[model samples]
Target: MQKTSYLKELVIKNTHEKNGANNSKKETEKIQSLLNLFSIANPNSGTGTSIDGDFGPATEKAVKNFQKIKNAAQTGVVNQNLFDLLALPIKKAFEDPIQGSNLRELIVNTAKNHLQNNPFELIIHQQGNSGPWVRSYMDGKEGSDWLWCMGFVQTIIDQASSIQGKNFKSLMPLTYSCDTVGVKGIEKHLLTRYQAARSNPSVIKPGDIFLIQKSNLDWMHTGIVIDVNGDTIETIEGNTNSMGSSNGNAVANKIRNFKTSKIDFFSIAPLV
Candidate 1:
């Protein structure tokens, strides 16, 4: 059978239904993964069920809600249609069918597109010069005067993940603080320290994040990696300029030398 078909069969076989037999731990885990992804995509669809591998009333409700959204039968069961909907975004995002092209490549492509388009526009605000794009980084929570470098990076990652029906918060912490991202990386064991990444530059690839360190425990600036070459790295940064600064006026493309720069690198964990 085709891989996708086989996978669908596996999910259906293992799924826990409202009135059906309880699913095995493994089966329930798979279902929970899909539920988590769905919740991230549709926050109000009752799909935000806890991913504890227990297909209880909440999971059933979430399934039913998702079914309604898809215009399918509200069976509250993991059926082929449900599986297909869960997988559609990823399949659509990577339809090019290139071998070994992973989600990171998709993220890099998205960031590159933003850089090429320069979607942000400078506007005078009560706080300072801001724009719609900058506000979007904060999900419209913070104003223009806010330090939004980390928000910009987080927004790009979140947007890219959304395109593939994945959750950015599941992959990385959704924070506006660069230091918070660095701390979360260390706590989650997802961090590649600056010195190590500099010594072994191969670890710094496109879609990775670079944090400009202000002190031993503080990061003042952030950016997304678009390309990495020997000794030099290309980045798309927010609130930066021709001469880079964490509090610069707008988003701009930048190049920095890893060996000579005081930057820490955080490698984003791959989506399951």
Candidate 2:
């Protein structure tokens, strides 16, 4: 509990210290409360600051190492995305979920590892892309199209097991995973994250994922949860599929009506 407690404290301090040398007790407390769902994905990341609120070299290096392992940008700065990743704290109650969540984190970490340790340029699959450059050249295959989101998730699992010195059901029960691919400039799909928001306004949370099905047909398509309040849930989703939407890759996803829709796969729901 102390480590859990301390880690939360550290995040608040780190976030503040990141802003400046200035300290905000309220800000620290608030951020910790919000991020308590995340845990220390890498315990061996070395000792972080117990006080002083500074995200020092050790912590930064550790995070960079963590990011490198997750295949995320290895910038040492504790940005919003990285901070969101660390939102779930590691404790007994949250530990199992953290473990499951860590599995997700593991994916990013492994991608990071591949980028650094591998001889070839490792392109971990981002949700949507315009071309097929990397998928075609795996090991000894041409035009293989051999990449899948589940594959990306599995890479993380393999790496996580390595870190924990254990074996996990990498692909596990095949039923636990499901994914879809779509383009933005394409035709009308299911309810976009935006459509769902209008219907089930309560379900949309920041950083949460949005899944869109066929034209108003309504279904889950995208995924990623970032933050949430009473009405809207902001998220980072995949498979916008070039529908000519604004914003870079992510858009304002949500539940528009009073009801919410749930995806059938294991991606959105919590795993035991």
TM-score of each: 0.60, 0.27
**Model 1, stretches more than 4 Å misplaced?**
1-100, 121-126, 142-144
The candidate 1 region of ten consecutive residues with least summed lDDT is 1-10
Clash counts per candidate, in order, are 0, 69
lDDT of 1 by residue, 1-272 (tens): 00122223223454467556756655564565556555654678777665555777888888888888888888888855577676554333323222225667866776666554343324333444343345455555435557878877776676666666777887666677888988888887777877888789888878889998888788899999889989999999888878987777667888999889788888875662
- lDDT (CA) for every model shown? 0.67, 0.34
The best candidate by TM-score is 1
Candidate 2: which stretches are off by over 4 Å?
A: 1-147, 156-162, 165-272
lDDT of 1 at 203: 85
What are the C-alpha RMSDs, in order, of all predicted structures?
A: 14.2, 16.9
Model 1's alpha-carbon lDDT is: 0.67
